[model samples]
Target: MGFSVAYETAELISPALQREMIAVTNELSSDRAWLSCEPPLLMNRGGILGGASKPNFSPHPDELAAAKAAGERDGTLSDLIQILCSVSSQFDVDWVISHDCSNGPLGCIRCGRCDPEVQDQCQVLSELAEELGGCDLDLDDL
Candidate 1:
């Protein structure tokens, strides 16, 4: 015979909390295993068990940059980019960033609202995109 249990994100608690919960459960059954998973990308919200209060959310420029930096530090970004490039080359499809923002891939800057600082930031993103052999797609087309 087999048993199954299912729960929603609201039921997920912190690791320490989980340990306590597991201890309670273990008293009834000692042969159970536990697993946990987190969202792949940096979420704008909804991290807690009950979910975020805001209905809409998106990644900020700084958050995107930090995520990129962390990925590069861990070598995950490089590995993923290499794999993408190889696959894209095989299919002859150009790799590009697609989004609704006017700034670069990170989507931080507005086109007409560009100040000196915004220009510098956009320039940096453009250079980075070029270095990666990818370009930002104009969201206006979509």
Candidate 2:
């Protein structure tokens, strides 16, 4: 299959979807309801050119496990990326948004604070990644 950059900020948010990524591994959980109700995780970040910051919550792993745990799930990852894409799109002017998976709520994954949009994005991305096999799943299409 061929691939084209679906989201202009793909590189920026790619880290959250990185394979077996350790950045935000600890935050995600097996609870689908939690993810849906409150988003996956938060992402604390500054400008790429600025100083490093805290981590955030994401849904990459939990969703992957859920999908694998289940049988059929397609919108999982897309839901996530859509959220991310939306936030990135909105923040396109003020900041360079991405899925850095850093600086969230906990110490494991991206630990810090993130906007609701980023959290929503991560949740959607996580859901999609999970259904698609997470890291092994190629979301380059987005």
Each candidate structure's TM-score, on Cα atoms with residue i matched to residue i, is 0.21, 0.24
**Model 2 regions lying over 4 Å from their true place:** 1-111, 134-142
Query: Each candidate: RMSD to true structure?
Result: 20.2, 13.4
What candidate 1 gets wrong by more than 4 Å, as runs, is: 1-75, 98-102, 106-142
Candidate 1 vs. true structure, TM-score: 0.21
Evaluated at residue 92, the lDDT of candidate 2 is 42
- Model 1 C-alpha lDDT per residue in residues 1-142, reported as the tens digit of each score: 2111111122234555444433432342222111111111111123222111110112233544665565522212222223323333433323232123324332111221223443453355445434443334432244
Give per-residue CA lDDT, model 2, range 34-102, as digits (tens).
332233343433312111122112335666467657753433333433443344344341223343442
Give the alpha-carbon lDDT of every model: 0.28, 0.35
Clashes of 1: 0
Number of the predicted model whose TM-score against the real structure is largest: 2
> Following a full C-alpha superposition, what root-mean-square deviation does model 2 have from the true structure?
13.4
